[model samples]
Structures are given as C-alpha cells and as structure tokens.
Target: MSDVSRLADRLQRVLARAQEERTERDELVDGPDGTECAWAAHERDQMWKAVNALRADDGRPSIPLDDIVQVERQAAGHSDYSRKFALYCAELAQK
Candidate 1:
C-alpha cells in the first residue's frame, strides 16, 4: 500500500515479464546477437539501481551505473536475486 511496496510490485512484474520473455526465447544469450535479452537485462538493472539509490546514505548519494550494470550481469540468471532485491527495496522504502 506504501510507495515502496508499489515500487516493489512494479519491479517484480518487470522481472516476471523479462523471465517470461527469456523462457519464450529459449534462454537469453547476452551478446551482440542477443539485443533483446541485453535490453531487458539493462532495464532490470536500471530499476534495481533506482531503488538502491533511494536507500543510499545522504553523504554517499549516487551509486555508479557501472557497478549496477556489473551486478545486473552477475544476477541475470537468478530470479531469486530479483525477488530479494525487491524485498530489500521495500524494506528501505519503509524507512
């Protein structure tokens, strides 16, 4: 019901949609030839970064896009990571 909860729900839907697309494509191969997968991954990463930024300390401010992109690459194959990240964002949003 809260803003963070709403954001988390939206993110979960995004992740689910990405997963569905990947499944339909018979797995997403991230490379020059895999533009669709790459774009989906990028979108997921941006959403995660946006949520993360909302929880950053005042002094630290922004997280580098490169860092977020790297994390997205590492987490792309794991649906658990997406769910956990959404939960984390919700927790932060609560505070």
Candidate 2:
C-alpha cells in the first residue's frame, strides 16, 4: 500500500482504540478516587490529544472532535478528506 494508505490504517486503529478506552472509562462507576477509572480516563485524554495533534496542519487550526468523527466517516474512501487525514497522521507520527 501507499504511505497515505498506511497512515490512514494506523489512524483508524488508533481511533478505534481510543473509543474503546473511552467506553471502558465510562463504564466504571464504583472505583477509588484515582484507580482504575482514573487511569482509563487519563489514557482516553492522552489519546484525544494525540488525535488532535495528528489532525493539525501548518497554518490551520486543529479539528474538533465532532469534525474528526465526520472525517472518520469519510476516511475509508479515497477522497480529499482521506488524503488530508493521512497527511495529518503522517506529520504527527514523524514528530
């Protein structure tokens, strides 16, 4: 596959894992002050930051979570959104 294709795949995996972590954190209802739920929440937050950084471009603002979701919906195809999303992932990964 091409570099953009590879990066898009990686982005998809990362987004999926982030969603899973968010769900796991939300499911926790009776944990200690800073235990299981806290750890998951922290992981979720870090994942979100990573995603936001990945989506940022030079001279452009980072995309919000809602927009990211829309991009995700369109990323499977070889559209302009997919190309930009792949480029963003590549830029972030190189850093």
Candidate 3:
C-alpha cells in the first residue's frame, strides 16, 4: 500500500494503546503508582514518539501533543474522527 496509508495504520494502533493507557492513568486513585503507572506513561510517550518518528522520517518538524489531543477530542466516537484522522495523516504525510 501507499506510505501514508501504511503509516496511518501504525499510528492508529499506537494511538489506541495510548488512549487506553491514558484512561487507566486518569482513573487511578493515587496518581502514578509505580510500574503500572510507569507503563501507562510509557505507552502515552510511545504514541508521541511514533508521531515524531514519522515526521522526522519525512524531515518534518514534530507535531505538538496539544495539536494531536485536539484532533483526538474533535468529535465523539464513530463520528467524524476517522475522517479527521485521515486528514491529519495526509497532512503529516506532506508528500
């Protein structure tokens, strides 16, 4: 498949893991309780790292987490999120 599409698929998986981990982190009662919490933080970091790696691969500046969070929160589940993500991927592609 095309490079952008392939990258998008990878990004989707990473984003899903990141979101799941973030939920766990947010729901924790004591806030970052060691290994489990560390894992959650690592997952979140992986998402941004993947994003940055993709951008750096194309010689583009890394996108900010705030910008990505904006995209993640743009719409309710199963609404226009996919379209937004695809558009975001396309923009990231810059190809």
Candidate 4:
C-alpha cells in the first residue's frame, strides 16, 4: 500500500483495538452510564489531539500519541461504544 494508505490503515487498526479494549473495561468496571459517557468523551479528546498532531505542518517525524500515550491507552480501555459503532467510528476516523 501507499504511505498515506498505510498510515490510515494503521490508525484504523489502533482504533479498532481501542474499541475492543473499551468494551472489556466496561464489563470489568461495571460503571454507570454517566461514568461511561465521560470515558467516551475523554477518548474523543485524545483522538482530536492525535489528529491535530498528524495535521501539523512541521517536518519532524511524529507519532500522534507519543506524548500522551498513557492517557490515550487508559481512557480508551474504558470507552463506551458497542462493537458495531466502534467499527463504524474506526472506518470514519481513517478518512
């Protein structure tokens, strides 16, 4: 695949994996809807941060989550999406 396509594919994989982890967390923690909602919001915040970094004009090589990787992973492990929606979001995020 071309470079951009490869990058996008990798991102999709990351998102899909994040979704799976999130589902597991919800099951393990037994959090209420409000807590789950907050977790989802935080996950989106991390995603936007990553996207902005990816869109930056600097020439330096970067990985979007390299700085806040811990937050990204932890928050994602508790995201509240159902499997279908998570897959849908992953598909959209790639575009």
Top of the candidates by lDDT: 3
Q: What is the C-alpha local distance difference test score of each model?
A: 0.56, 0.50, 0.57, 0.43
**Weakest lDDT window of 10 consecutive positions for candidate 4:** 27-36
Q: Who wins the TM-score comparison?
A: 3
Model 3 C-alpha lDDT per residue in residues 1-95, reported as the tens digit of each score: 87766777777676666666664464333213233444444543565577778788879898776555444445327575644564465455453
TM-score attained by model 1: 0.41
| Residue 55 Cα positional deviation in candidate 4, in Å, after optimal superposition | 1.9
Model 1 lDDT tens row, 1-95: 87767867866676665566654454454643354555465555656555555656333445444544554555556768777555454554344
Output the worst ten-in-a-row residue range by lDDT, candidate 3: 27-36
Model 2's alpha-carbon lDDT is 0.50
Q: What digit string (tens of lDDT, one per residue) describes model 2 on residues 43-90?
A: 434434665665464334654444443443444365665355545554
User: Which regions in candidate 1 have their CA more than 4 angstroms from the true location?
Assistant: 26-67, 70-79, 87-95
Q: In model 1, which range of ten residues has the least summed lDDT?
A: 57-66
Estimate the lDDT of model 1. Answer: 0.56
The residue ranges of model 4 lying beyond 4 angstroms of the native Cα positions read 21-36, 57-95
Angstrom error at residue 13, model 2:
3.0
